[model samples]
Target: MANDDLIYKTATEISALFRKRKLSPVEYMAAVIARSEAAQKKINAFTFTHYDEAMDLAKQAEAKFMKRDGRVGVLEGLPIAVKDESWIAGKPTSYGSLTVGKGYVPDRTSPNNERILKAGAIVHARTATPEFSCASYTHSRLWGVTRNPWNRRYTPGGSSGGSGAALAAGMAPLATGSDIGGSIRIPAGASGVVGYKPPYGRNPDDPPFNLDPYCHTGPMARSIQDAILLQNVMCGPSPHDIASLRPKLRLPTEYKPIKGWKIAYSFDLGIYDVDAEVVANMKKALRVFKNLGATVEEVDLGWTRDAIDTGMRHLEHLFGTQLALTAKKHSKIMTTYARNFARKGAKSKASDFFKSMEGAVRMYDTFGPMLEKYDVFICPTNAAPAVKADFDENKDVVRINGKVSPLPKVLAWCMTTPFNTLSRCPVLAVPTGHASNDVPTSIQIIGRTYSDADVFRAGIAYETAIGGWYGSRKARPVL
Candidate 1:
């Protein structure tokens, strides 16, 4: 197979070839490394590449296969990209911040990442993020701008921007992403890839964040099946994370047909202003669901502007408060965006946080019943196609449908965060179509809280009806 062919192949396809001995692990590693180098040059997607260690691991995997060892794990020999925000033992973890992370390298590994390594997956690179993973765009003082593979002028979205770009550019077959205020799905929608933010506790995470429902660590890939492939290994209970669900749920690789199922879709979730291209693509996607023998209906969420405010407040209380404290101590070294985000967070009151919790309850009061009637809810992952790579959250105003939106709430441009407020629900963001701006648009499949399987079932059904993002090399980023 040609190098590009191997690079673009899904994990399932690659594993099949590996089992058949048609593609050796060493060969696959070389192909991925070459593709990653080319992609990095074009998009600046990775902060660090582990080519030397990856090559050694690939050779060992090949030897095991040659000996016909039955000890292979589910993700045996697949190249996976680790997000820099997650800890990898003995590797420098900057968390995209020079202040808190003074070249710090942890001795312990994050639970989900440890699972990835144990699954026989090769970590070929560490993807970039905004400083402190604090913004919707992926440029930082530590690493340069991370651009979309589809259009160099636009951003890939953050803080999982690098992961999304790498997957689109075929830098890796699978990668990890964390969602808090739409970090995972925003990039997924922007870069035209598959990203799943599993229900809180579905996947084990390290400390304090594991207790925060709005934060999730999940999988990103080129196909739904590949996302499931990685999720199966990354999920389950961990001794370190008490919040992790017990009697762990392992999602099925094969999904039941969505024929005769009822689906609810909303373009703007009844509040935020959305671009016309996003609306058009969502309409087309709804048609595909109807063509697949499913009933698609539009629902009114009646979610007010308060929903956006509440979500932002929750972020402020969680990450923003601490970020502000860090800025106070190291304002000189912190990124301007980080310092500004901290300043905004510092202004909120303790009582205001209660209002945020009230907002989540109100959102669920409406959605919980709607979900009971419908098997799944569908919506645009992002309101706009994507912002510029260098767009500043502090200074930029997002325009949707030719109307300028409120500034400094750049996270508002994405529709993915309200679901973060309803964090127990499983959300899957997949490419819908490309906009006139040349960035890909996406639709999210939302299942009832903790009903993770329903979303994937719906996702695969749609994926089968209209092939996946990898369906056409023409549709893929030219880079």
Candidate 2:
């Protein structure tokens, strides 16, 4: 195997090797750092890296193994990476925009970061995100576009774009990602990595909105098992987050295929004009689930394109609001998309915002009954293949199979975002196969609300049968 090939071990595999003295965390850290340095020059995937700090953590991890008494925490010597949006004390939080420049260094940190550190995971770098994470794709005047790893000519997907790129490029085995609207799943599918977006509050955030909220901090990893392992560490009810689930539950110790789990599959959620090849790959994946003893069936989410469109107009203000908070001072240097997104957010009337929130409630109310009939919902992770590098997330119009689709911007053809808006379900995006066009594709496995582990368990079964989805191409610069 080539040196790059040897660098692809998952966190669990690395920990075992570390415990046996076959590999040192320091060696693993250096290997990943070297990969990150090479890929960073091309992809700009990171906002910051702590090479010295990472080595120091590795030395501590190495010493723990030297004592050799028990298994380390779930993260144990893993070289974890954090998104720039999540606050890390002493480290600058940029929210992917240049407006903040360097004024704020958080004295207080997010509980999510604290939880990971308590588990012994070493967070050695901060990944880039879209400006205020306003748009779906990761492009900002401050950090530039984060290119895809498979065919650098394409986007790795966004918000979590840097996390996705870093993982696919072998920069890290696992990283932290937050998804409000497919930020986790889109990039996971785009980059052919497995990303898990757990139920809201599975990993708690800091105060303010913590009283009761919908946002989640989840795990993005190279495979389903890796995603599961990291989430296992990160999950638990928080004193700060009232929305957090009560009475912590243990991670299912066994992930064996459930003998008969009912899975509902949809190509377009009933009304989406998905690419034909995307439909075919989704079908291929459902068949794999069938072979694994799952009862796969056709199901509809009861949402027409019109309904979703109506909801989006009102719902988008939530994200646009952040841009307005940072836009004026940074407007001159902001990407056009960021500026527009902020202005639109600031202009949204309360009537439109509430109307959208109400529309979202209607969707969720109808979705709950459907879940009673199924163990999970399976769908195409995205409506299309990885978009070309120049594909603009803000202004680009997407055509599906030559038909001009109505879905707006980067949000079009997405199956993962609806879950974010409805039922607060957890979804895992796992690679299915490659298309003839050299773009990678994926299948989404969504579990019932709060059954985050189930989604990953199913993903592990699918991945094991398919031998996991790594692109055939080696890492190279897109530009």
Top model number, TM-score: 1
Global lDDT of model 1:
0.89
The lDDT leader among the candidates is: 1
1-479 in candidate 1: lDDT tens per residue? Answer: 56776788889999988888888999999999998988799999998788999999999888777775567878889999988988988988788887745378899999999999999999999998998788888998878789999999999999899999999999999999999888999999999999999998999998888888888999999999999999899899999999899878989988778889999989888787899999999999999999988999999987888888889888888788879888888888887788887887788788878999999999899999999999999999999999899988667778888988763356867888898999999999999999987899999999998999999999998888887767556766888
Each model's TM-score?
A: 0.98, 0.93
- Where does candidate 1 clash, by residue pair? none
Q: Give per-residue CA lDDT, model 2, range 244-316, as digits (tens).
A: 7777655663587855989888788776788888878888888888999999898777876655654455445
What are the Cα lDDT values of the candidates?
0.89, 0.76
Candidate 1 lands at a TM-score of: 0.98
RMSD of 1: 1.1
lDDT of 2 at 247: 71
